[model samples]
Target: PIEVVGLLNDLYTLYDAILRNYDVYKVETIGDTYMVASGLPQRNGSRHAAEIAYMALDILSSVGDFRVRHAPSVPIHIRIGLHSGPCMAGAVGVTRYCLFGDTVNTASRMESTGLPYRIHMSRSTVQALLSLDEGYKIDVRGQTELKGKDVEETYWLVGKAGFPRPLPTPLHIKPV
Candidate 1:
């Protein structure tokens, strides 16, 4: 299982680097899935949405350069999703901090229904990004059915606004 271990190491490294630069907090990481959040335990208002959106894009760009130790020829791809709303956060059991509410569930649904190597976001997140004036580009994904939540409009975070179209080709490593 060296491949799995190596992949996890690479991913953790990437996440660690991102955490150092953003105000977001790591919610959890189960297997290859990672969950992070902002505006919790400290409430920074709409800035959380912008932080998450930027972090998601940075993650995608990093993954583009990541290669599997066992399968170096293949590029690693990640699907990220985000939602902006209120949620309750508190310690669960003995030491685990957990998030509860429809917002969390909706965010999970966004990831579950999203495409690989893309960032899917709820309309609330999009609006937050706009309000923050972070210069992010988004493409409407139209109405999508979400579990437990009725149909909702979603969008794909394309990149920073006013940047070159088609975005730069994601960095890649040559097959070993």
Candidate 2:
């Protein structure tokens, strides 16, 4: 049976509040797959990418804490991805012009494979975010083959809104 549309009014109300405040790009809603982005239609070099990633992480952390304190019955997790590169931005179709480019594709892939409550980024985006004034807890997840590219490195946004520099990689490695 078709569900009532107004059931998620509160959900969408809060969701819209987030998208509007952040540098949200296009949001495609398919069922529960919420895809959003930044650093498009108005690129700010590389800083925009980092800022967006930071905001995403912040939002996730806040939501988690809020749920624990208020709604213990409902827990929500967010997965985000970010990438920075030269993408061909253009308007296609006369009636409905839309953006298209390799950068966008890569970003989507990053989101798809991202872990819940985590922000994944391409090597370029990681480097860009590292250069920002804010401190971060980033982890170098090594290189991974991103879609539509020969090879791409990946990083995970570990933490923000605290810390002075990214903490040392927490790994247990022994001689091979």
Candidate 3:
């Protein structure tokens, strides 16, 4: 639908801005799906988990006010999944960069099985974040079978450990 397309455009623009504030890199996007990673190209230690977590939370907050162009009454929602691990990165053809490994697959599963407007994270990612900063608020989502992988623990990133504050206004690009 035209509305879905417009929503995606808006999201991509917002994502572009969000990406600038973090050390993460945008891997790729297929349709409505957007993939990103940190500690890649150059490793940043446990900080990658925190950076990704912040970006995910910012995205969730931004999407809350995002309206579909064709159907303003309809709300847009996205499910995000995060996994921290090693992966192989290389260029495929021309300027196309690709990431291949079980980490990517597991992260995809986290998103596929996650609830809309929420950030689902794997145990490794949570541990990484906690190790860096215990100020992150996360809740366990329990064990679930993730396709080829057996049941594994999952978590939901709620917010920073402290009191919630109003998020700054997100940059919106008017449709051309």
Candidate 4:
């Protein structure tokens, strides 16, 4: 049990640092579900979506090499999802800031339905990423009905300017 806790802690630490590097804020981490956001607490226009995408890629790549302390041969995997739209953000509690709105919920839906080791995003986020005009490989996942929601166009954030399309997975990663 301790090993599990330690593994999660280390992973969280890694993510916290990575989020900072991308100028994104680590909103919270409930168990294995880590939440992050940008363009809030200080608005940065259309950069939030791209920032998240980059951070997600970095995290997924770094995770490929992150092995458990108890089992050095085993690597960790995570999923990421993004939805770009206006949301209400503020310090909800005494010391905790939070985001509320359809955007936040939709983003959560994207994450919950995402596949491991991949970044699943909505059309709005794809549009936001395109705003920068920096070529990021996006594979069309086509329209799908999300949980409790109508069908919507979804896409996968494959890679960006520096990261290659279909990021390289370690040999340790295998099909389920």
Candidate 5:
């Protein structure tokens, strides 16, 4: 229905702006699946991981105000997954841009295993964040199975240094 389209548009619109602030890139949004990336096209060093992490937190918190035109009372939830690694990206057929690699696949797994209203991340992503700063709050999610990959540890991104934890986000994700 048109209402669903409106909901998707509204969510994307909000997320896109927040991503821009963090210098993250919105690769595409297929239905409700929105894909994003950083440190690509032009490299930003390891900070790409941090940028994506902060952007994900921002977008997830924004969901608190997001309303579906069809159901304003229904709360919206989003699951964000982050993996830091290499990938091949470029505009493909029909000029549609794409990122292809196991990195993308593993990132997808992080999201699939993630719960609503949370930002799930791989250990690699955590390492990248720690490399840049020690102030990002993270919670251990323990080992999770990824398709084509053995069981691996994962985590939830709670908050970042110097930034107010997202408000009314239930968990209110604060630093530990």
Candidate 6:
């Protein structure tokens, strides 16, 4: 059996650290499966998806590197999926507020079906980010048929560190 206690501690610590610098919706761990999300509670316009993408990329990269350096015997990698859409968030119980919506399902699937260390995003999310600022560089990975949604154009987030491509130039995103 896996070290459930150790894994939970690690997940909680990592999740808390990521949230300190970026937005974090929630962190849920069942057995060894850990799921995290950003851009909920409050949407900062279009930065939601991009922010989540950045966090996911950094977290995966860090965890992968850590495993490689300290625990080379164990090949550790995590898959991430991100999608943006309308969702209702509120505090239903007296104890704490919980969020629910179709976007959650889509995001979960994106992560589940996604390749390790990759950020799978829906076309709608890409458009949302673009609408806010076309500065983020992205490449199209072709359209995908998500679990719930009929279909969606998918793209991999390359990086935002570089300047945006010229308007006339076309963008091409690849699977990472």
C-alpha lDDT (0 to 100) for residue 83 of candidate 2: 74
Instruction: Please rank every candidate by TM-score, starting with the best.
Output: 5, 4, 3, 1, 6, 2
Report the Cα RMSD per candidate. 5.0, 6.0, 6.5, 3.0, 3.8, 6.1
Ranked by lDDT, top first:
5, 3, 1, 4, 6, 2
Looking at model 4, residue 78 earns an lDDT score of: 74
| Between candidates 2 and 5, the lDDT winner | 5
- Poorest 10 consecutive residues of model 2 by lDDT? 167-176
Look at candidate 6 and tell me the lDDT of residue 175. 38
Candidate 2, residues 1-176, lDDT tens digits: the string is: 12223424444455666667677665455555555556666766656766577666655655554333244576555567777777665666664335467877888878766766667788777777778857766787666666566656688888775633332322333212
> How close is every model to the real structure, measured as TM-score?
0.87, 0.68, 0.88, 0.89, 0.90, 0.75
Over the stretch 1-176, how does candidate 5's per-residue lDDT look in tens digits?
Answer: 78888888888888877877886777878788999888876789888988898788777767877888789899886778899999999887985778999998999999887877888899999999988875888999887888789989999888887766563353444322
lDDT tens readout by residue for model 6, 94-174: 755555689778877777656655666777777876786747667786767776667667886655655323211122434
Cα deviation of 38, candidate 5, in Å: 0.3
Per-residue lDDT tens digits of candidate 4, residues 1-176?
Answer: 89889999998888877777886887787888888888877888788887888888888888877878899987575778888888888887698998888888899988877777778899989988988888877998777668778889899887888674345452333322
What lDDT score belongs to each candidate, Candidate 1 first? 0.82, 0.63, 0.82, 0.81, 0.83, 0.63
Candidate 2 lDDT score at position 139: 88
User: Who is ahead in lDDT, 4 or 6?
Assistant: 4
Worst 10-residue lDDT window for candidate 4 reads 167-176
**Residue pairs with clashing backbones, model 1:** none
**What digit string (tens of lDDT, one per residue) describes model 3 on residues 51-94?**
89988888787778777777788767578899999888998899
TM-score of 2: 0.68
* Candidate 4 lDDT for residue 116: 74
lDDT of 1 by residue, 40-154 (tens): 7678866899888877877777777777778899877677889989888999888688898999898999998887777889999999898878688889988888888798889
Clashing residue pairs for model 3: none
Q: Following a full C-alpha superposition, what root-mean-square deviation does model 5 have from the true structure?
A: 3.8
